[model samples]
Target: MEKQILDFSLVPLGLCLLLAYHIWLLHRIIKHPTSTILGINGVNRQVWVRTMMEDVSKNGILAVQTLRNNIMASTVLASTAIMLSSVLSIIMANSKARPSEIVLGAESELGFWIKFLSILVCFLMAFLFNIQCIRYYSHASMLINVPVKKMSSSHLRAEYVKRTVNRGSCFWSLGLRAFYFSLPLFFWLFGPIPMFLCCVVLVFMLYFLDVTFDYGGVVDEEEEW
Candidate 1:
């Protein structure tokens, strides 16, 4: 038996927000310059643009694959949680039932429902990831093949140099990295109340690494694809 659950209402909102954020990112990637001029304070010099469209398209494909993987992982996670939660709910719902009643029927029903809900959420999430994967991969491939100058970076090939604002795979890889940090949603379960508070420490750590400026010169060898 399903009880009144507040989290159900949140699913739609969370999905919408994630969709909007990704859509916005895809738009910016397709429209914006390869190396954005960061007007940080006043010391704004041109930064190096890494990975032209070809590289980015490859990344997008991988991102699509990663989304597919996430769908599977989250499916397991959500199913387990939902099933357990539902079982607890069932036990509470039939408080009047004797211990035998709870043991014989209530537990089994709750477990079944939880597994079903898990599959449902997993299916939805998998569909969403697959759609985005195809859309992004198509965008990236088309952009890479197009002959247009999207940036002024002389380091890239003449063919790629002419083109600017084409879909690249870097965005997807970065997105994947971001997702990895969130795998299993530990932060949501037991972390700080506000994200800002936790991120402050992380931001400082990232900033310190950024300032270190460690690097090896770009090795322009043909990748063994």
Candidate 2:
């Protein structure tokens, strides 16, 4: 009963804390585009797209190479996520470990399955997001090379390409975020206290990593885009 109580009390609270932090981060990204790393990266990607579109003949190869690198990165992460998910699925199917030994929740089987499923979901989400990232990055690779004036229509304009690139980046960030979230879920298998503590520590680390105070110092204005 004590273990069950701890699980009930701590698990939801930890999850809510994580969800709240992301909500706050999203609000900041929307309202202050220059304040967060994601917003700043979006701005820079747009500038990069515009610059590449200006002289496609000269920048075409460079643009392709850059997009290729991004695609490779997404591919690697996607592969890793899917592999982990597969391993987890296998373990869940074959596992006979006593709940008394491994899990600390109410119903041992139920708690055990819940933890496995949560971790599995996280990896699956990461895989899906990275696949989306690859999709967008692949589309942007070709779109970025099109001459800006040639695509005069609004939908076909450089803005569309910028949006595509940024979307890929956004997916990449989301995939990474899913991987980050898995850390807490993994800890939850040990106990609720560890899970909650991990969530607090992870949020604190992410705040520093995701938000920026010295945007100008970080990105040199003198460097031509």
TM-score of each model, in listed order: 0.27, 0.90
lDDT per model, in order? 0.36, 0.86
Worst lDDT 10-window in candidate 2: 216-225
Residue lDDT tens for model 1, 1-225: 232232234333443444454465444333332212111100111111233334554454553454346445544544554454465556556657654443322235554444334434443344344334444444434444333356555346423422221112332334332443333122222212222233444444433432321222121222100
Q: Tens digits of per-residue lDDT for model 2 on 63-172?
A: 99999999999999999999999999987887576755655542668777889899999999999999999999999988877765665584457777888888899999
Off by over 4 Å in 2: 95-107, 148-150, 154-156, 216-225
| Pairs that clash in candidate 2 | none
Q: What lDDT score goes with residue 192 in model 1?
A: 24
